[model samples]
Target: MRPSVSKPPACLLLALTSIFLNAQTTSQPVISADARTVQLERRLETISSALVAARQQVDQSLQQIHELQQELAEIKQQLPSAQTVPPNSSSSIADPLAALKTSVTDVQERQDTLEAQVKLHDQTKVESDSKYPIHLSGLVLFNAFANRGNVDNIDLPAIAISQPDGASGGSLGAGLRQTILGIEGSGPRIAGARTSANVNMDFFAGLAYANFGTSAGIVRMRTASINLDWPKDSVQAGLVGPLISPLSPTSYATVAEPGMAWAGNLWTWAPQLRYAHQFPLQEDKHVQFEFGLWDTPSSGYNTSDVLRSPSPSEQSRQPAYETRVSYGTSSVDRGLQVGLGGYYSRQHYPYNNNDSWAATVDWRVPLGARFEFSGEGYRGRSLGGLGGGVYKDVLYGTNPVTGAPAFVGLNAIGGWAQFKSHFTQSFEANAATGQDNGFADDFHSIILPSTATSLQLRARNRMIVGNLIYRPKTYLIFSPEYRRIWTWPIYGQGNTADVFTLSMGYQF
Candidate 1:
């Protein structure tokens, strides 16, 4: 301003200078703000991309979890109830990691179980294990039997039909007619209970030959039944042991040795429907009650032998009933057992109606370490099927004037006792004696011919048997036995028989 010496435009000069200063300060701040906006946009873009990727990954994980759950459900359905997952399982978690962990654990458990199942199935299918669950049972036996007098066939010796004393010579035979085979099965459970079935067969089929009257044996059904096991209760239906005589003295010598007709062993097989209930009294001790309705209590007799071994088959219109109550020391039959039993039946004859009844008691005791004793006693009338009353179910006599048949019950008493000792794990010995007594007056009243063998109904029948068995293994046995049988005629001299037998068996 001094150089130009201009004092008139000082205001204009000041305004121009103010404008220039404002522009300089605003330009620097605009550049710095633009740099910060660019940086913020880059960070936002990165965050958005990460969120989208995470959503896709989570979707895939959910799909995988769903598939896994479906598989687990399928596995559960196929598995038996015994392998059911626990209700309080922690697999219901919400966290993905936790849920996945649970799924993995469940899958592993199911896999293990499935593997075990597969293993079992594989084992069962093997030739050696074809009957794994259905375990093969029973024995194969050959017997050499010799008798003092001619008797029945290879198996049982008929005391009544035996040759009268001093009338005939003795008999000897060897046979393989006592082999036993059976199949038993344990299958899938039902209603929280186990189910089982069995079919037992033996070669004791009477007097049958394969061809040309050869010794080739015929097979017979011993027992075939199904068992449903529930808690403390069971139901059985089929051909089974008689309720009145559930236990028999163990015999390897001959199948007949256990219950030879005159031996007072009231053992038989009949079709039956039975129910059993068990009540626990204390540790290792319990009580059981059983009852059954059986097939008509017929003597299974026909024309030839009907006179003496008569049963009220023609009159037995109603089923036989049996009931039993027992106390035991253990679940298995190894310990003491005591029981009482009853039987009732009715005969509906066109002209006569009768009731047959019986009361029985049985005991099995374990004496000390290696000894055992068993006994049974029964009182009844006309118990033909049970081998009592001289094997006559009901007494019959002809009405002298009416020319009609009449029947009366025959009073009877019977008992048996057995003692057994296990000399060692591989050796055993036992003795048994039994008797059946029938009222002699009833026999005398019958009108049949005096010489007719049926008229000689046994007033007293007794048997004693002693045996020793050597079992090198549980499935193999060798036995030798001696048995003496005696029968008293209703009014004449009695007859007796002596039997010697040797047996060898292998059980499967």
Candidate 2:
């Protein structure tokens, strides 16, 4: 206990000295909240000094009380009886002990109050530094489904164009495969530019996911990117959406429907490096010019066997190039945006050559506060690498000219439009339609033998979708959608299927 009294005073004295030194070291005449912060520091210094002085006085008083207690104990030991003791001696001891107890209580109370104030001050400092803080965002999704007709690979199956005459039945299942996780951060400065970064992933991809059922799913990368900007120019690099299709419709049924991918929606994500510069027209209004170079989409290795078709990577001889010019009144809600873009890429063939390209116009116009219209349209050849043309790049068959197999290129036209209405802050509805049509004549142009009539190629895909969204809170959403798809393949007349979907999600 004696050592404890000395230790508290010594530690508090050290703290007071350190606080005083900190106050002296800060000489800036910074103003606003900074000035207030300095003022608070100086006040803390004063409080620390008072705490040290009071602790020292308490230590001294405690030492005096200890001495008195020893004296009183000796007095009691020597006393023959209470009646024989001198009245003033006994009274004096009792009086001072009572006062010492009061003094100790007062010191304890004062120390507690000062410590609380210091804690509050520290908390205030932490809050002030917390501006531009990092936050976590993404969602946990649970989906339950029953299909009247079988679809392509399952995890989040897309509409399969297989002829209805096939032996496939139907399926029923539930899963958390669409659950997502992502981290978001901002307020970093880089090379004299403002920088922000985000990374997102989900268990919706992998070889295992191709047959994901009640089994656990494998994780897949969704987005890993960074954006750095100056006042008028910006740079972005990562796995990102192509500028050929700049608008996307909101849908909770993304996993199953893909919003409108195989239809008129040219949707694809690839690694790319992009730069954007803006010409200011007025306040919050500008014309933005963007140019980007994307990784050469590979159409895997090619083989002479026509049965073993080339993968996307094998089709590319060089990286894809794209540029877009768009004008916008603002980027906020109810704003208007319109752009025209183009894409080009060269393809490599064994002792042969092919080229692919696209030209498109994309736009969004808000009819009013509650209604909007948006879409993109493009014409591209061998664009299957970008999720168009039903994933078809070329038609392979016998060549009458060379008396060998030939790879004939294919072309397609695609576009998707979404009309949306927001009836309230918590509820909205969307209707969208799109189509990807392969050139029928181009498919017929392939020099195939009369005996090679078994090729069943897709000629067209069409989709019409309508959905309603209900958001009960900022973090929770519920949506149900109905999608109708019609597909035409050279093998049969056409195949049609209807997909109904419901999804629940919570974002943080």
Candidate 3:
């Protein structure tokens, strides 16, 4: 004879199916790709809670079954030894006990099903050729924008410029070049330190400018690093931003170059080897020191797209040096912090050698639970490659007396600050402003070359931005942003432009 079988209740079956579907289809928004792990942890917690409740109900049922069996045994013992139960009475007593056993078996099957689900979830990981595990994360971002005046790069403008003859005066467009993709992995620990690596890329290298140029963006590497992290020290080597200028205003609308690229944010990524050490303090506070050697590029110079050439800094045959010291809460994502940093490089030019240097200060202060302030400021010369001095490292012209080419490193001071309000976990607002000013004295008596671009003579650039980001669903984001830029040329009237953008993104 076939053995009896029990099926799960319709409600329980439906709940399990829903959970599986949710895990496969739903995700949470994270500040960065690394935060994907946090979202996964939250999902696991929810499932664990459900499993615990079901187990508790099964335990109670088992206890009641035991009590019933005990009572039946006692009643049987009280009867006379020769007494025989009637068929009908025996049927009534045994049927209920058999039913109780079946119920317990059903609950046990449900528990087994839940355990299998958790095991399956744990096994759902990216398969790698190597023994180590790998994970994939990314953001698919779409941006629609409208510009009310002439500006450089219509989709991702950095500066306002004077309108030329027959100019359209404005433009409306959309694109997906800001989308980012990343891959991360972990390796075996060595010398009491954990090892990890990640690489990020986007389609922001350049545009095709063809019939479907907006849809055809070139792929480019954003940043990549291999890190060894100890409890109080770390080492990183890869392409990254300058060590002296680490803080940048947060804005999804400006992911290609960050919130303030040419207008004050010194964020040109370069290959570097860096080391950091931390000193623990009371509570959550700590002090850190960081140093790095970077392969800085030369700004205000053109390079061939088809051939490789050494930049002025590279021609110097020496790497740039940078160092920073900061004190703050140990949290890397957010908290209170203040940092001071410095950068130095030697640039070899055809005419002469120039010393490129900067002093920088950055800060992040929490005003309360819902608000925070962050900013970075710097004073430097010959910093155009690092996004300063109005994108000009040095001004060149004919010397009046000697009739020989002369070059002078451009001096500039600029910074950006932002005020952020986190009204809730799923919504926030931000306002920020930045400026990059090249001193007028640095531009005097210099005759711009005929081959120079219109922006080569730019003396100053200022920008203001405001935006609201809302997350209606866990992994969906919608943001609307406004930006205004004012730019002044060395010998011409200043120009202005206003930009409005709507950005939508899905994270996974």
Candidate 4:
């Protein structure tokens, strides 16, 4: 005869298997404390389910034990005193009863443990002062770079500039000023819409004038918005991206300034009130219409930082107007989108009143599962405040013919396009090029003078960039980028520069 052996309950086997699998998969990066909490919650859920099954099994066993007790009583009544029953029989009944009791005790202990763990998890959650749900997200970034020619700024340079006299070589540097922090919260619904708000800040304002100022970056507000969203309509008010030109190239190396800032990317953030409505179309297609009132300051109009004064645009006592219409497929990847936009504003300068305006077109097209293309184009005048026209809004100097003060809004046309290949969920590559050209005729004879400021003379700027971004973990990123910039002045020879950068960041 084979020897008899005790077997563990099925619920216990299932629970142990789940725990072992979870442990095996959790070798991946934890990302944040919140992620660990989520893991714990899932584990507790699995264990709780097992405990429920164990409890049911115990209940069934108790029912059988009660039936067995009743059967024994009936047997005693039928067999009479002679049925003193075998000693072995009493031992067998007691042993099975003991086993069922042990199973019940085990399940109860597990349930208690699960309850304690759940309570602990609740105690560790972050709570907002107002008792609303709040989230904190940010990136800690480090960048190292090298440049091969003269440029406007060493770190995150935008345009190439003429080499100064006696300038011998390029420069190399590293910094962490691009790090960012953001806070967001959701509020109670109001006016039949969900309300939420977010604010983002970065340490990229500028360096101090003191020692080691390179590492002492000032804090700056990047963007902030309050949103009221319904099923198909939404309203937003805050410091946000320009409504006319809505897209930017992908780059981790140019966070302080967006990619291709002076060379076609018009990505200035400003205060605005926006209203948007979406119309659902056939299939997964949709159309969106956006209108906004924006506070557009004049380019290079403010000379004093310590005093509060109205900008040229503000002095006009009018806000900029912007509108855009876009068509898109609402697929998981947003398969295709195309937009057309318009902008108009008035600038009141001491010398004259000028108009700042633009007409824009933007597009995003997916080539396939792994490739995509995106771009934006615009023709505008006096758009320097919007990161256009080589960062100049107008040419200001004495008129050559009249010998009087003259101000001309610079006419400019610019655009940027990028080809992106997403090789996998964690790796990608991008190549892009852009150009912003200010009409040389707009400058007239202003640049011929030996006394004119350099900003007033630039006529065109162009750039090409290529980068590879890799994410070994969800919360970590690494990228290496190369960029070439060419800048032209209304007078004299053009300048070119080559920049190389490595960026690493951790996000949470």
Best by lDDT: 3
**TM-score-better candidate, 2 vs 4:** 4
Off by over 4 Å in 4: 1-126, 331-334, 445-448
Local lDDT at 228 for model 2 = 96
User: What would the per-residue lDDT of candidate 3 be over residues 1-508, giving only the tens digit for each residue?
Assistant: 2333334566678989999988766553334555777779898999999899999999998888786566555434533342655767866586666645655565566668789858865894677776786878899999999999999898799989889899999999999999999999999999999999999999998876776535668999999999999998999999899988888997888998888998889999989999999999999899999999999877746568778688899989999999999999967767899999999999999858999999999999999888999999999999998989998898887676787777889999999999999876678899999999998887776666766666678899999999999886557999999999999988768999999999999987
Compared with the true structure, what per-residue lDDT tens digits does model 1 show for residues 1-508?
Answer: 5867665477678888878998888999899999999988988899989989999999999998798888666545534342644567655443447545656787787688789868876675424343436566778888888888555444556573446567656777788877888878877678877888898887766656465655556688888898888988898888887787777877876573355454677776768899999998977789999999976444535565236443464356568899999999864566889999999887665576777778999999999878999988889876776667666665566555675655567778888898999766677899998888887666555553434454335577788889998876456789999888777766667777788889999876
Order of models, best TM-score first = 3, 4, 1, 2
Question: Which lDDT value does model 1 have at 141?
Answer: 88
- Please give, for residues 1-508, the per-residue lDDT of candidate 4 as tens digits: 2333324456678889999999877756555667999989999999999999999999999997686566555434533232454766867576666645655555566678789868865673568877887778899999999999988888788878888889955889999989999999999999899999999999888886775445657899999999999999999999998987777899999987789888999888989999999999998799999999999866776788678678778999999999999999876443798999999999888858989999999999999888999999999999998989888887877788887777788999999999999877678899999999999888875434567767777889999999999986567999999999999888889999999999999998
Top candidate when judged by TM-score against the true structure:
3
Indicate the TM-score of model 4.
Answer: 0.75
Each candidate's lDDT (Cα)?
Answer: 0.74, 0.74, 0.87, 0.86
TM-score of each: 0.69, 0.68, 0.76, 0.75
Error of 2 at 480 (Å): 0.8
